[model samples]
Target: MCASFIVAAHIEQNLSIRKTAAIFSVSKSSVQKLVKQQKIEGNLEPKPRGKPRYSHLNNSTASLREIVAAHPDATLLELCELFGQNTGNWVGRTAMCNALQKLGLNRQKNSEK
Candidate 1:
């Protein structure tokens, strides 16, 4: 959306770099650089940046909840294998345990279990 807005401001709206940046609530030099790049490449696609998402939580939540509910006493490694087999996702043991912990299932100390 930011890329689209920047492209629209520069191409469709025919706005100057400074004016485009001001209108888009971004830095003037930012707009100037984008405009320069667009003019050079004739492209406006936004580059992908930032850390990549590891898990697809949207679809995994139901499976995770079911697994946790079915086996609250399951170990971290057990949960990881179960999730991987059932949902076709190989989650790290630590990550799976952390997720379970977030859902109120923490590993008990040696004496507690």
Candidate 2:
């Protein structure tokens, strides 16, 4: 998508790289890089786009799921604490929450009776 936007930016839309980057909330260098890549490689896939998987998380996903399944009401902080205890190193609350979300373990708000 970013590549399409960049390639079409000049003749089709007459939008500058800086303007396109600002509107897209991306770096101008990204737009320029993608434009160059499209011209050279004819492909637009983002390389190294997101966080690399943590080996700890991959190796212990089963244990983490077990802990959460045993305690569905646990808050993210609580999960992090438990994870740290199990792994001997702390997992960030954000990472824990993301993992739980991916695992279908979201904490929905409970309605009071």
TM-scores, all models, native as reference: 0.48, 0.49
Per-residue lDDT of candidate 1, residues 1-113 (tens digit): 37667867787988887788778888888877777778887876666799877754335777889987898778888988888889787888768766766666556745655
- TM-score (C-alpha) between model 2 and the true structure: 0.49
Each candidate: how many clashes? 0, 0
* Native-to-model Cα distance after best TM-score fit, residue 58 in candidate 1, in Å: 4.8
lDDT of every predicted structure (CA atoms): 0.76, 0.79
- Off-target runs (Cα >4 Å) in candidate 1 are 1-32, 36-49, 109-113
lDDT of 2: 0.79
lDDT per residue for candidate 2 within 10-73, as digits (tens), equals 4378888888888778888988888888878788776787887774565677999888888878
Candidate 1 global CA lDDT score: 0.76
Clashing pairs in 1: none
Query: Relative to the unseen true structure, what is the C-alpha lDDT of residue 48 in candidate 2, on a scale of 0 to 100?
Result: 83
